[model samples]
Target: MSPIEAPTIEPVSPERLAEASVWIAKLHGDARGRAIEEGLRRWLQAHPENARAFELATEVWDDSEQLRSVVPFRPLRHVEHRPRWGAMATALACMLALVIVGVFWLQNVGVVATAVGEQRQLVLEDGTRVFLNTDTRIVVKYDKEARRVELRRGEALFNVAKRHDWPFIVTAGDRQVKALGTSFVVRKDVERLAVTLVEGSVLVSPVLPTLPEQIQPTIDAPGSIEQTPVTTALEARKGAGEFKLAAGQRLTFDAGAVTKLDTPSIEKTTAWRRGQVILDDTPLQAAVIEMNRYNEAKLIVADPDAAALPINGLFQAGDSAHFANAVAQAYGLVVIERGNEIVLSGKPIQ
Candidate 1:
């Protein structure tokens, strides 16, 4: 059976729209406060247009897919008495204008970012679920023909929903990883891009100079113009060295070349998802770097010998103090607490 079409909504007045925008922001901002909730309830009950306008504005906000870009609505500051309707209405109008502009901006570009010691899960308009790790940033662009994501920094895991006609591709640095109906993780660093496939398959290849023009949609003044459908399979195999990675396999790209292909332990590679950092004979320096990603206080290996020590353990993410203490006891190193920095140095041999 065909899906029923949703009825078209008439345009709401600017004043009403503005009020609705402010109400939505306040409600979202102070969801647990009873005062705001009761006030909003009374406001909605006072006028029929209030409810309709709020519903319309909310629908637009939900559909925009870029709520992060919008300026959050802040409650009005305390005043001597109740403000006049004219003043309220004027404030609402300005907010509504900003909402309109934000909606348009989000239509073309959407960005998601996470700070240190933070993780985020987001479902895209295409139904793909993305799990972003600490200090991660990604830009998503979806159009009629293709769905694309650029990993600007850090790491993310993609659980892509199947849409054979629309290819799912993630680009980081000079490499592109293409997948369909698969789950994979992409980590971007200063000099390398790593693609690890947990289930299904993916093609990891170098990004050609001309590839961007072929994949990105043509944009005009108002909106994007539909371009030719990107052929994922063909593009993966053309003009570059491509490595087909199966489940449990990983492909690392460095310096515009395929550096390595290995089958790493999936649990170890994805340990961050479970809020733990697992180290299996990892170098002390590298382990310190991993732990520091999750904490504000930095960990520093003060000696070359201490930095080269082998580390193996499973510890909660951001437990730098515990890690430092453990390492000091095990290796007989001195742990110097210097403000926010934890420095590990080898004990002097007597």
Candidate 2:
């Protein structure tokens, strides 16, 4: 009988090994979720070398005392309970800045915030540059082992610095993004989280908590309907597992746990970075929602007919009056100013 040949093990490249290292760290971090599990499964199955690389990385990560001792940052349990701002009228811009800086200094963490109609830029201690959009907030925590940021609310763009041993992670709600060094935009809205990769790859995974499966009514034997196990919006998202976004790709995770992946228009995605709101056949109502994020005056669409009208153009951010007037003129609607609110309705009968 021929002697059994030794198994051929494909060699893992340095890039694959680095990716494995990041994955190992994330697996041990607070960002572990069903999505991460599935992502790891896929990555391991993609190639034989991937499994070897992951095993090798795991061995190193386990043996390194520094890696094991790195404590993950826990989000603040206390949320600031304050009256919601109808506009940017809560406080003066300068006053808000002072208050934010005080909080940062006292907490020993970098807290960057932007009120309505305001934007700011900052360079973190790790050389990461962040561009905060209007009405945004982010808390940065950097330790000897890792760099992390908690996006409490709003949107921001991150230009992460390269640190192979120290991974950069951003956590928003129940989802998180992991990167070594890359440029990406992260937006946390009321019920959604969106991430757009600009120049490098990033891992987008949900945090803990596997959303429960939903139940649906299905017809049984006769005419009676019975409850059946069904996948929810979030379950579908969980099924997609963790997302590995490429440059120019976008991912949106809704509060309901639904996920959408697309290669959007980079120009449109980064328009806000240039202080412009670019709309491409957007509905009047949706346009108002986007415009309101950066303006002091609230825009309300009072008429359903007018709200359904399509708007297409590039407009300045925070210029609610200009956006309202342009939409009204194009759709022949009426724009009425009521104190700080701009109401758009159907034109009155002549």
Candidate 3:
């Protein structure tokens, strides 16, 4: 048998649609506190049309940037008070025309990604800017309550816009970073997760699991092997405590049970934005890993000695040859080219 489908929801009448737009404007405006919320609840409960109209208006608000310009010129009235019906009809007609002509309902949710050695910049409908590093993938979804972004892989810097009523959150693996109006970077590697706050505060916490009833149970035969979920040491050590990170602070979570939290230099943390990598006493193996993130060519430290050598200074990203030459001249090592791999080996002792 085929799966069941959800019932389709329809929008409310034209007059209610106009009133809903006014309510949305009021919600986003300076109006606040219990009085505003109470008024909204009463309006929504008055009729099914009022509720449906409000829901449609929210979707329009999420997708239509033009809707912002249509907000009332005069100070918004309280929810308890109603605007003139003739003016409301005029507004509704204008919104319908704009929706038919411009708004397509695509920008409210989508995926943004970048390839290796490629960088990208995107501005969301809410005016928040996202800067993606090499080999990054992020999913952006905006709703009435919040603006959410899932950092599926690689790293990205979020310069969030201020929306006090609407929160902004980024989720990576089991962890999430919540912000209001701030700048921060979240990087997800194969075995590690790093969050660095650049200019604003963010709350770093574990993502809560879904409700019990929503989870499906799995049954196995008598001789079958039970599948176990993989839990990293970092997650095991990261208890239920939520961390509030201030600007310039960095949190590193890896396979190790220890979670390191420290204040790192903002310049070094964000140097990738400039297509440069700055290494300060970083091991050859570690530096190689960082450089390979931006280039198709791979760098291999041929021996343990070569891999342990310390590297420093700034170098252009994706320039593996330049980095290899610098290392060879400085440490008297041998650089051998093998296909796409640049092998660095120690000079043979006499």
| TM-scores for the candidates | 0.62, 0.61, 0.62
Q: Model 2, range 133-199, lDDT digits (tens) per residue? A: 8899998877655678999999888989888787899999878899999999999999888999998
Collision count for each candidate, in order? 0, 1, 0
Q: For residues 119-221, could you state the per-residue lDDT of candidate 3 as single tens digits?
A: 7666576667787889999898777767889999999999898878879999999889999999999999988999999987787777865425323222244
Scored by Cα lDDT, where does model 3 land? 0.71
lDDT for 349 (candidate 1) = 27
How do the candidates rank by TM-score, highest first? Answer: 3, 1, 2
Query: What would the C-alpha RMSD of candidate 3 be, to one decimal place?
Result: 18.4
Model 1, range 1-350, lDDT digits (tens) per residue? 22212222333566776777777666554243788889889989988888977776775445332211111111212223545645554444445446442221122247988889877666565557787888999998876556789999999999998988878899997778888799999999888778899998777766765545445322233222122234575445443455667789877767667467788999889888766788888888999999999998999998887776778777778788878877777777888999999999875222
Pick by TM-score: 1 or 2, better one: 1
Please give the range of 10 consecutive residues that has the lowest summed lDDT in model 2. 67-76
Better of 2 and 3 by TM-score: 3
Model 3, residue 334: what's the lDDT?
90
- The Cα error of candidate 1 at residue 280, in Å, is 0.3
Alpha-carbon lDDT of model 2: 0.68
**What is the Cα-based lDDT of residue 306 in candidate 2?**
70
- Tell me the TM-score of model 1: 0.62
Question: Which residue pairs show backbone clashes in model 1?
Answer: none
